[model samples]
Target: MKRFWNWNQDGDQRQLAISGVIAPDSWIHDNVSPQVFQDELNESQGPIDLWLNSPGGDCTAASQIYTMLMNYPNDVNVKISGIAASAASVIAMAGTTVSMAPSAMLMIHNPLTIVGGQEKDLDHAAQMLVETKEAIINAYELKTNLPREKISAMMDDETWMNVNKAIELGFADQMLGDDHQPTDCYSYSDKQSDLVVLNKLKRTSQNTISVKSLQKRLSLLSH
Candidate 1:
């Protein structure tokens, strides 16, 4: 069987399924290129069901996919079967109707990058990042009327939202399939708490090593 998100149009709905992770060499960029996306859009007889479960990769590639979906004439329904994080969430917002399985998740975060350059080069990279972020924010805003500040905060925190939470935040228009609740909803506070515990353990281990070093020094001095 063909993998999901690889531009397989042999489904029941005569709808194309775009599923799986998003990366430069991923199905979106390799198997389903821009031409393929245009062909699919031109030939689609009905609504397109986009199943997203990806950590997200390749901002440029994801942007291409997002643009194609947004330009499609037919209705585009995005179903979050597992998780849509990072750039994957940008594509999801392009769907005319966004829904999520009761057990599925959606994550939104600011675009991140690593750069090494002089001050001027770094400034240019920073500007590009800002533009990219604004583009993503515009897409989300178009889909849901949520305030920019709210969306910005959520993205800054790398917020994870379950079905109900997604609906409440306007990330998802509805919930599909099952009527189950998510295991637990986490906020930035929860992440911080976990980090605190981890830091405490590290500090305790360091103190133990320091005491051992002091003991060895005292023994040597006595000798």
Candidate 2:
């Protein structure tokens, strides 16, 4: 895999899928890069199905992606099938509708950093982190309607929530497999003349759809 994160439009361009960590290409493995993310976001149209299974990384990257999703022209549906913790949780907050798999987990906490500097530098760093946390809280509050104090306390405690707990706390709007079906899908067939699928999901991995795959798909469509 080129990276853990993958971005691609589903068949018909009605929906898109964004999977894996939110900050790939960082020193950390299994993360999404901000540049790649922006390119993907720019090309996205209509509704998007963002499948998140991440441990999170690079708060700044997550924050930027969050803003991009929030500003998208159409709706964004975030589906968490594994984990959306730390900065990934922040990105989840941008979803127009956030759903968690029955067994998925969500976590929230204060931003972390490594610092080596004078007292003034330390103080400034603390203040910057506080602002970052507050910004994160804004995203959460928009979805959960929870007070800032409550959200902050949850962060302070490093809270982890499952599906039901997530809904109870307003962290998630619904459970996966609710009213909306999985919106992201693909199509492929060994014989173009028979068993043509409109939209089927393989979901094999969080890896980029290879160019060969796209070409094959187009060739099949043109036949």
Candidate 3:
């Protein structure tokens, strides 16, 4: 089985690279499950320098990973080396300090699922998605301090943010570079703060459509 995450310890900081799709072990062979990640994290010492590059995948998996990172005792400095979209964006929110590459991007949107059943089942699925969206909002709201309604609206529109825009909107703390000091914040045009993702949208797979698989994956989320 191929692994989606790579870990390397240097000095007191543990470097974790999260790439490709995030999913439970039973769901797929190539994706990284939250349990496997947690096992590695439990044994690590000191702070974490997590490098994230993913188009997102199973939300249940992402939610567990997010919770683990949030509950970690030490600091978790997230470095966005590439795009972090959908469920991957949720994991990014666990960062104590989030830094984005100059050309990197981030995206968030409402959760989606494929349901096959009667009218009542469909209604149940819709309600579940609504609740899931609220749960996801908790993470983003905690990180960005943006209003829940505003965040909902952004998710409704499938918001995409670039480096400067990410900092402006509180999705990111600062731009990654050697020239800028750690405390320096990036600047953005008020009018251009919400730019369309354009060509990059194609790079990210549809990771939010795993709600149908949640029932099967929930067992892996046990603490």
Candidate 4:
């Protein structure tokens, strides 16, 4: 994953280029230092243009970046160049004005977790997930002015919105530039491999016998 937010300043103009993954290991965390942000803020005399192109990562990091942008003194304009999914959506809403390229996509979904724990721990985890979901819904409602219930349902369904749909939903404010041909990251070969693995797992499970049946047979043998 590549991630980085670049701050460029020329005389009175300033812009921040944000691209790639939004995780701890991404370019944003590694290359975009706090000093860079500060320097841009101090030197720039104009509004900041934030160009975003990301697949989303690290909720906590995205939240931090969102807060930073929201609290910035100057105006923030976000231009989505590609896809902004999950936590990236949150950061996009931090901008004073959000613009998406014709080919861009916006996706939202509930947080996910995989846990191995006792019943009590599992219950607690479920509760935490619910609360997190509610929080994410609240953010969407605040930005889009849509009903929380509707937003919550969309999140549950893992909604994927195109640029036009995003604009209609109020998630995107404007469409910028001409549209290009859409390309899916996953190839046909990858899909075939996934299907083969799934089929093998299904076959293996189908061939397995229940332990309860084996135990009953053992009891009969002992008699």
Evaluated with lDDT, which candidate comes out highest? 3
For residues 1-223, write the lDDT of model 4, one tens digit per residue. 3336777775665778877777646334455544454455566447778889888876656766776776666567788889889988988877766778878899999987678789999999899789877877766765676789899889989999887787667676667753231212212233222322332232233336553454444456556
Could you give candidate 1's per-residue lDDT for residues 48-142 as a string of tens digits?
77778887776776788788876665567788888888888888877766678878888888998789989998999999899988888887775
lDDT of 1 at 198: 31
Task: Point to the candidate with the largest TM-score.
Answer: 3
- TM per candidate: 0.70, 0.72, 0.78, 0.68
In Å, residue 17's CA in model 4 sits off its true spot by 2.1
How do all the candidates rank in terms of lDDT, highest first?
A: 3, 2, 4, 1
Worst 10 residues of 1 by lDDT: 182-191
Q: Per-model C-alpha lDDT, please?
A: 0.67, 0.70, 0.77, 0.68
Q: Give the clash count for each candidate.
A: 1, 5, 0, 3
lDDT by residue (115-188, candidate 3, tens digit) is 98999999999999999999999988867767899999999999999987887877887678833454245555
* Candidate 2 Cα outliers beyond 4 Å, as residue runs: 1-4, 13-21, 24-33, 180-223
- Across residues 1-223, which tens digit of lDDT does each residue of candidate 2 receive? 2355566666744344545665455534534455566677777466778888888887877787788887777667788989999999998888767778878999999999889889999999999899988988988876665689999999999999987787666666667876553222122223321111211111221238753474467567778
Q: Model 1 clash pairs? A: 5-19
